[model samples]
Target: MSDVNQASQTLLDSNPASQRIPPSVFLLTGAVAVIGSNSLVLSPIAPEVAQSLGVSVPMVMSGTAAFGLGTAASALFLARHIDRIGAWRMLRIAFMLLTASLLVSAAAPVAFVLVAAQLGAGVAAGVALPAIYASAAAIAPPGRESKTVGIVLTGWTLSLVAGVSISAVLADWLDWRAVYGAVFLLAAGAFAVLVFNGHRDKVSTEPAALPLAALTIVGVRPLLLACGAFMTAFYGVYAYLGDHLHSVLGLPISANGLVTLVYGLGFGAAAFLDSLEKRVSPRLGLPAAFLAVALVYLLMAMENGTYGAILALAFLWGLANHLGLNLLIVRLTALEPGRRGAIMGLNSAVTYLAVFAGPLGFGWLYTTAGFGALAGLAVVLMVVAILAAYAAPSTPRN
Candidate 1:
């Protein structure tokens, strides 16, 4: 049997009555889906939101920026508490906060109100995401860490597939308010599940590391730098892909949606490859994944003129990204188990900081130069990630 399958058999032999996958993992996955969906749902319905709030589309997009800003701030400052307070408790609090924020967003009277609500949700997500990752790592059976993390990360695929698609339909049929309302229901449902079924962690007596202290941990700084580069490249390209398709390629919005669907499909497909990482050391596997991303960006830069090439590259981009992301999380979570909440919080902080900064920097490049120049910059960023991953300290296997 493959390592993953054998690990499953081991888990099964240990607990005959239990499902191969634990209920808690699924619950954690649901929580991740809630946060992921909230992050991405704004783009497809931006026009509807703008029209409803009587604001320009740029003003509506500022809500997304506000959300990113809030997340970055909270992740840096507040996520350290997850270790001290316990991951499960932090997650429950996040769910409550998310539910309340979504409700406020659904009922908001103006664009500013909507932005404020999204900012609140972003704060909740900052802590919620690190707690979710820490919880997933904590609950993983021996030798199943990669498979388990891959499964929880699939929540992003859920967001890409169901979240954005459904929000668009709801906006078209009901109104933009229904989109937030639906997310509110999902958040509330996940909160209910955690309240009833989730296990409580014994609060640690160990004080959580401050953000600066977290950087002192072995491998953290380079890993976080890699993470920032990886995310910046992704967000930079993603921010303009649809516009590139629409204005340059003259493809309809539906076609752009299809491209996103293809990317999501590719992301989901990469989950099957996660088990393969068990056989290879992450030191080798991570750099290879990062190199794959670098290659994809290079191809995108060279082939920016072709629709078919762009579509195919998008799939490869998603696939490489999934592998890179999985390895990054696994390594970070392994580095200092007791301090995972703090480390992963740094991960989210850098990621959201990239979310705020990537587009702005890439936008200037794209406007002054071109898509080719923008993608070329992404390639350079991926190169930085590859080098940082190569130089980082090794992680213990779970």
Candidate 2:
């Protein structure tokens, strides 16, 4: 047996029935809390930040793009290092860097400094995410890895909801800087948890090397295509929801928080059901979810519906996106067990690349062709994602 197996066996022997939360859960939740908080809070404060720094809203948004760029840039290198140094140790280093970056961003007095800090945070998140996924896969019981990962990842979705709603209220009462300050405190607390508990150790004797050959294989083609299309559509919708609601519906700024809360609720619900993947194949779940989202977007584009309808559609969109994302991670990790770290890192890299494109492309379309065009594009992308799912080969869980 491998070292990871040995460690898991020892734990199982010690506690026969209790479900032990893997160390990856804590680390991933902490890192995602930071990222999700920043993504949601900063969008609302873009105008304020621009005014404070003597820049344009586009420049403030560019910080988000730069952060995605940093994530994509570091993913491959971090994957290779994790293969050599072990996931837990790499995660500790990632948390340290992330904490430092959060502090720097909170203290930043200029746009350039804030951009640099966000970039660092993105790199840290990129490094941390794949390691977390791999660790979850390594520790989880057979037929339940997907559910375990979903539980861990739910922290991120929650952060997106809570971060935006709470930060919006805080920004109204206080200042945008206060939002970052709060997350800084949260990060500090997470760091304390890591120091006190110590990361879970894994055992493996295989040689560590880059999977350059695997990267070129046609086997992962369907998975990559699915991830790219899904991410592009998902982020395109999410990144601009606030602006879309305000512009198209003539809603107030506060409405963004409420709309996001609905979206978050939908995602949270789907995540709760994702643990049922052992009985249901993602192959069946994924396409159905996307088809539903496509219909919701179609409805939004066609009519200026009642507030109830709009909220329902937004929630459904969030639900579909989360289900697809969680399933994709589970599928890709299982594609090649030996190269789980590298494959997941590549997935993060590709997904972030899509994230970078989604906002820019959608924003351009929204500016030129109006909401109808954007909704039509989303329909087409969802169709492609569904087809990709159909084309992917099914892998059985061990």
Candidate 3:
């Protein structure tokens, strides 16, 4: 059997139907909730945290940057270790570390301590995300990989929507620390579910190593550049959406949450649409989504405090961003099945590097050129992604 066949067989053999819950269902659901909750729950509380810690808001926001930086820093090294340690084991460790980090963050008495806690969470996420994606690919029936990834990734959308709405309410009713405490509790619950399920499977002992040169040689250079550009634009908008809504439209914090929730809803909707690759080719659907995002940026640029208009643009942006991300993942996995871990690691590193840089870059752009200019830049980037999508080699069906 070929390496792909052998890998797929190993995945299926280890988790007999009688002994396992479908890996896709369990991992996707848990990962969505776990990863989403971290950012969604914490973003609304940044100001409150700064006040409580007697620091500037910018200082409190450093935690977010630290998280992104930590994720970027650890991605390559962690990818090397995932198969050696077993994907499931790495996931468990990630969850435990995330839980501990949340608890530490909640209890932190100083801004620096909270930033450190978030950094730990970011590193844990770096390990967890690639492992989750690789396992999804390994365990999913061939042809269902994109759908599985979409479902798992939808957790992010749900978290963005639900986490922010719920956290906003929690922040209003109680202290920001209370919000972090709730997130810690949720992480604890997710950790337990993963642990209980994972314990049932005998760990794979095979050395699943890939040649570094193979990873370098695959047609990955364009894909990595595409991932970075897409994420930089996607995250640049997301990082400042709340601030932009408040500053530009004079909307209240509660209103900002509602706008973000709408965006999240769009993201969740894309999970369903992502399955359309079965009906429409990814080559077609992917570029269509990118085009939709470009249009949304245009709408955003044109908006002048019209709530309905903003809501509609936000929704489209969310859906398009996620659809593009899922397509990229599918493309990468198809390009090099054996090196999914390394490719995904490179993908993750590029992605978070964009995330880390987007906010700062956008802040400068927003100050110098205003929202219209920033939106124009976003449109230009999406156009570039569209061109890249068209240029990518189509995956042959199995």
Better of 1 and 2 by TM-score: 1
The positional error of residue 388 in candidate 3, measured at the CA in angstroms, is 2.8
Most accurate candidate by TM-score: 1
lDDT of 1 by residue, 174-274 (tens): 88898899999999998998888749796679877766688988899998999999998988777667656766787654555566666777888999886
- How far off is residue 167 in model 1, in Å? 2.6
Tell me the deviation in Å of residue 378 in model 1: 1.2
Error of 3 at 52 (Å): 4.3
**Per-prediction TM-score to the true structure, in the order listed:** 0.89, 0.88, 0.87
Per-residue lDDT tens digits of candidate 3, residues 1-398?
Answer: 99999998878766556334355466556675777677545555555566678986446666777787777776766765676666778888888999999999889989899989988988888888887787777666555677777777788886777677677667657877877888888889888888887443234455645534334644577667667777777766666666566667766557666777888898888877744666777567667777888888878777885878888887888888788878788877788676667667777777777767776677678666767777877788888877777777667543
Q: Taking the tens digit of each residue's C-alpha lDDT, what string does model 2 give over 1-398?
A: 99999998878767745456655565666666666776556665665567778987557666676677777767756665666678877776777887788788888899899889888977877777777778877777655677777876777677868877777667667776787788778767766666666665664566655634447644467877877887777666666665666666766556767777787788788866654555676567666766777786687677564667778887887777777777777778878887787787888777777767777778788778776677778888888888887688877665
* Candidate 1: regions farther than 4 A off: 1-19, 47-58, 171-174, 304-307
Q: Which structure is stronger by lDDT: 1 or 2?
A: 1
Q: Rate the local accuracy (lDDT) of all candidates.
A: 0.83, 0.72, 0.73
Q: What TM-score does prediction 2 earn?
A: 0.88
When sorted by TM-score, best at the front, the candidate numbers are: 1, 2, 3
For model 3, the stretches where C-alpha displacement exceeds 4 angstroms are 1-24, 40-42, 50-58, 199-217
Error of 1 at 270 (Å): 0.9
